[model samples]
Target: MADTPQANPQTARVLSVSELNRMARDILERNFPLFWVSGEISNMTRAASGHWYFSLKDSGAQVRCVMFRGRNSYLDWVPKEGDKVEARATVTLYEARGDFQLTIEFLQRAGLGALFEAFEKLKQKLQAEGLFDETRKRAIPAFPKQIGIVTSADAAALHDVLTTLRRRMPGIPVVIYPTPVQGKGAANLIANAIETASRRAECDVLIVCRGGGSIEDLWQFNEEIVARAIVNCSMPVISGVGHETDFTIADFAADRRAPTPTAAAEMASPNREALLNTLLQQQQSLQRSMSYKLNRYMQQLDFLARRLLSPAQQLTHKQESLAQLGTRLQNSMLQLLGRQQEKLLRLSLNLQHLNPNAVLNRGYALVQTRDGAIVRASSQIAAGDPVNLRFAEGSAEADIRSTAKPD
Candidate 1:
């Protein structure tokens, strides 16, 4: 292949691969800058230098791509093998390798709306399986004895959560279950950490947290497996994965969702001032109730004392009334006795006028039989029957030797 045109003397002076590659890169960059390119990624590799190398391919051809550490560090999403992505890149050269490549400045999932749609579909599928059920969610302890933190140990989110917890509730133990928060295998690692924390039963509540990021950066929390682990964990979980508006599957799966790391700490802690205020109000109400009851009892005592009358006073009043009654009773008895005596004398005189004994005393003689029966008729006398004669001065018994009947 080198013999035909490259054999010529003039053609031997042609630029080296490095020189040509550099010139091509400069010209391409000058012409097309900060432009977007859409393609499927292949052969993706992340080097120890934190740089990314990949190939962008379509049905027709493929091109080498590079994302230096500086640009790669700012990327929210890392391209994976077979992933379709759009990159804001600069056409440049790899001088040492003498290769033409695209140096990416920014990278994002191609067709973000499509990605979101796929995400939603997966979320719905998991939800239908009860993976997002509220019943399955563990209750966040009102006061967690120990808080288990699931995040990258080196992440700023960890420090934020720690600092906030220390400030809000001092002496509360924090158990860190460090895991990979981003990049490859991060989702699996985070999911396992959650499961481990739950299985161990070392913490009362689990906080799955991370610093703020774009949607792609927070994608691990949106993964189905990670979300499932969070929902299935026995421990009460609180998700503080991103800013206030950022939401993920993990957030939906957690029993409680906090907007930020600081907010999560707040949720786990009680406000000292609020508790104190409540206690004070209760004490004051008790005091008021006691005072009211005491005052009512005191008034009752005062009323009882005012109504009380000494026995001596009651006896003196009764005795004074008794003396008046006794004097009036004596006068009434004397008047009644005088009237009764006068009435009795009049009755005796009237009775004397009515008595037959008075007539007898005036010189009436009465005859009586020996049986003490007066003989009014001679027919009442029997022969040899005894008779009695009565006189006004004295009555004497006389026996009638014979009875005579008037002829």
Candidate 2:
């Protein structure tokens, strides 16, 4: 108000402070590129629009900050007031307010151990969430017919595993899933292979392994993506990353952790020699059990045989009775024959007494009258008769004239 701006209208029209600031903003924004900056956050405010406003300051200097939802949401962590933070920002000016500010695309706590601390915090959180539970651990099959190995094809660990498995058990077949075991995309490749192997369901168990290396070289296993993949796998996973001392997040998340790749193979199969020994022991035990059972049966049979009666003794008792029967049979036959002989003698005597031929032998001659007459009582005499006489041996013939009856 003190200055006479009307006296020089051209100068008045030349530039206002706000106009100059706006022009400067356009120029600076057009020319400058995005860069990283470090400072502690102050006066931090989050808008309902999902935008963040804050002041970034160091010991003496300070800058304004704005993180839109698009960029801020990608961050896994957020910064609070009094928290030292790093920002990827572009130097730009707000034309309306004529104030310079930083548009932050990303943010991280500023410290050397920030990443490690974040990792630990996440690990503890996931562990508490039961993601790293022992109950979820699966027992490896004792004798897998087919085994899937997820490792680099050219890795020495693969050879070591194969050699060990061959030595311990030569019968099992191995399916190899060639994947990067250490590198930028190693974790993703491993996870994809594991998923594929599970979907195939061809192998009973999977071995996700690699050769030993430094922690940084084996960082792929440390990644959370790999750990989650291991946890989500349906098949039991044996993590054999690095040496015994080297552990990664994958190791904790896996169903089992092997001390070495060779150990992983050993766990996948059973030792043939041990199996043979067990079978032989079982056979021996069966033989012993059978022998004892057979001996018991034989002893029972012997005891029963001793209690049995012999056929020879029963037959001897019957034989004595048979002798008495034979004597009875012979005596009955003799009595029958004697009775028959007596009847025959009686019949002969009766025949002799009544026989006419026998009477002839007794001197009683019989005569025939053929006109031979046996003179008994009939007509003992005839007045004029011719008679004939007959003896036992001879006869004489005669003529008969007449016969008369005597009164």
Candidate 3:
């Protein structure tokens, strides 16, 4: 340990190692003030307690740094390895080890001002144009004959949207209007594709989308030409560009904005499972209606046969015919009785289904007031109120008791 100098050992007082480190820590903290430091971050570690540990280094040297959770939690941007950053920190020494370090208070990127300014300026200009008016937005067709898509031919967004559409409603035809979604002249290409789809009028609705990227990479979707093209389109337009957090100018101008391309495809089509269930219900209802009608007609035919001949005709063949008619009448009465018994069985089952006795057969009991109003909640009765409990086997009266509210 480095300590105070003593020329004569006999006359000097010795200090412990702890005392030396304490003096060094005090001197370092007292001499240096909090200031800004610029460097590339490396060897970053985040603890379970939310504290961050890292080394900030330039070409020639490196220094240990820490940003406590309380200070760093409010920052919008997260710093990572190899990122050039400027941190405002306090220069201090760890009292235990006597090692130098900086305690970071704030952090930021080097060049965010210009892009932020451009984004704000463009947003204001578009708002003034009133291109995003709610009245101008059209409703998408619930069941479109054809769907059109405008995006890069090789984008991952195309694959996601196509897969969702195929799974939801494969019978609906899809039309692809390929365009360059980035780089030079991408905005103009997107605008022209919109215009082309409008003139053809082959599609019921159109989807314009792209994969997620940084502000510079997604700038094409934020351009003025693309927003105007969406407004001029004859068909309703949907904007599904980037991830859920990403937004673009085209999103405001379109009829609807979906967070992702897969969600956009889902919004465009109806679920197949629900449709199949509805068809099945309709079929069963039709069969029941037809059966009832056929039974009614057979009963009318038997009545007409009985009316065509009378039992008073005293001829051998006539008597035989009358006997036959009597047998048919007996058979019809038996058939009607069988149908009535079947209906009674169905009614019995329905009544049993609605009865609350089955519930009480289990361990549950019903509490009611003395006048017989069933208690549904603990709040309905106060503490020390007299009540009766009716069990599945028998009824019992209970005196005043304490009540507790449900958690």
Q: State which candidate has the highest TM-score.
A: 1
Q: Is candidate 1 or candidate 2 better by lDDT?
A: 1
- Stretches > 4 Å off in candidate 3: 1-43, 46-79, 85-110, 281-407
**Number of colliding residue pairs in model 1:** 2
Candidate 2 at residue 81, lDDT? 82
* Best by the lDDT measure: 3
Query: Compared with the true structure, what per-residue lDDT tens digits does model 1 show for residues 302-326?
Result: 9998888699977997898899899
- Writing each residue's lDDT as its tens digit, candidate 3 over 261-366 gives 9988887777676678878888888899999998899899998977665545447677798899999999998999999999999998988776677778886678
Error of 2 at 2 (Å): 89
> TM-score order of candidates, best first?
1, 3, 2
Q: Candidate 2 lDDT, tens digit per residue, 262-312?
A: 888888889989999999999999999999999999999999988865889
Candidate 1, 215: how far from true, in Å?
Answer: 1.6
Off by over 4 Å in 1: 1-111, 159-172, 308-407
User: Each prediction's Cα RMSD?
Assistant: 19.4, 21.6, 36.7
Report backbone clashes per prediction: 2, 3, 0
lDDT-better candidate, 2 vs 3: 3
